[model samples]
Target: MSEAQNPNATLSVAILSGKGGVGKTNLALNLSYALFRAGHRILLMDFDVGLANVDVLLGLSPEKNLQDLFRPDVTAEEVVLAVEPGGFDFLPAASGVPEMLEMDDDMREVLFHKLNKVFGSYDYLMLDLGAGISQTILSVAAMSQLRVLVVTPEPTSLTDSYAVIKVLHTQYGITDFHIIVNQVEGPADTQATFTRLSTACNHFLGFEPILLGGVRSDPALPAAVRRQIPLLRHAPRSPAAQDIVNGAVKLHRVRQQRQQALVDAPVLGKIPIIRK
Candidate 1:
């Protein structure tokens, strides 16, 4: 469907990573919270069907999930869980449901159509996609307006991230990407990590991803995770939380710029007439 026909023009962002254990989900959750706190209506959907855990991290026990939406009688609005205190919405995915991981063309189209209807009410839809380059992940990433790739300081993480980027760029033709360096030591580490990845991408893929920012390593993050609370709310002053807030601000600015660019672009199929 064309962008104008879509009811929800909400900015959709897919948060993904090349490998697991890179704190991608945590970053997604905290970033959603940060955006919500900044007065934006946000919906965080745990699209990691196999190991869905956004609710687990938030200590929420959602009775319904994306699985319910698959039923013909159910609607996407009914499956969403409104998080308390902040009023942000969370869409939990079905964990350990192998069927949910793979989707046929028809199913994929129906699911996204329902999602667009439900997400139309929100200003932002943050999809926490599963790690790696699964078909589902690539599909969702291709549809999203903003694609944020999370990477760590580890060599394996960087390599895997490059692999995913290469596939998306070459196979899916998705060149625009925003890189987030997670679990960093300091500013130098963040810059080094981003530079290494961007340099490789530029040399090979011929595209350089924008560095969204970095989240520093902090003890508070683990403690918050253990407590099943978002680090932003658990320890707002922590370095990691601060980093997430900064990243959210950058994301908002990028979204605005893209919107402006679209508005400024000239429309086709219009005829100009000379004035009398």
Candidate 2:
């Protein structure tokens, strides 16, 4: 599972939103399960730093979290938590890890190298980032090859999403961004929200944000979260579950097309597999 052996490395994507309580973690949790069901080796990373709850959502409690990796002598392998049944592994970020705000230069290098060394093993490494645009969280978001900006129909959500795109453009100089409208009442509502966000990004951010699609607001989401199970398994026939599957398919196709384009292009200048 080392980088050298994994030539067809997994595509790293971080799910981020400008504000909290917009179903960011819900999307990340179910999306990982959807990808796993689609037969890809997936790794769901809880990179929430101070307040990670991916474990609670999944209904599993591990004695070890990412804190183990930060210890003086623990190896990288010691921190990975394997989720049962789905075969998708995870790197959990629980509460009270020392230096949670920022990883020092040495720690950053070690983490980057460890990720590079192991990321090639899977087809997708999905990071569930914390809400808000903190320096640490935003840095992690920018590092990913792809980003999923989740938003609702709320005015605050739209405003915060704009702020996130602005930060990404100014701080990381990233132009490739995708939008996913969540918690919509219906297709019309989804369109309205998407249009507003897209117009703002194009007019002000100087970039066109592609619509990655939307997930209709479903009552089953919170219920599943309470039960600590993926919505796909808890309510497979639900509208939201089906939408998640559709989203996963779209995302998978996008990644495949990008890879194929890289392969077909004769120049092959620099493949942007991961941003960094």
User: What C-alpha lDDT do the candidate models reach, one value each?
Assistant: 0.85, 0.79
How good is model 1 by TM-score?
0.91
TM-score of each: 0.91, 0.89
Candidate 1: segments with Cα more than 4 A from true spot:
1-9, 85-87, 260-276
lDDT by residue for model 2 (86-125), tens: 4588778867564875665576556665555566657787
Note the residue pairs that clash in candidate 1.
none
lDDT of 1 by residue, 1-276 (tens): 544333344677889999999999999999999989987778899999989999989999888888888788888888888885554889999999887787666777667667766776666789999999887787778777789999999999999999989988877677889999999999999999999999999999898999999999999999999999999989999999999999999998886777655343321111122123
State how far residue 152 of model 2 sits from its true place (Å). Answer: 0.6
Worst 10 residues of 1 by lDDT: 266-275
Please give the lDDT score at residue 194 for candidate 1. Answer: 98
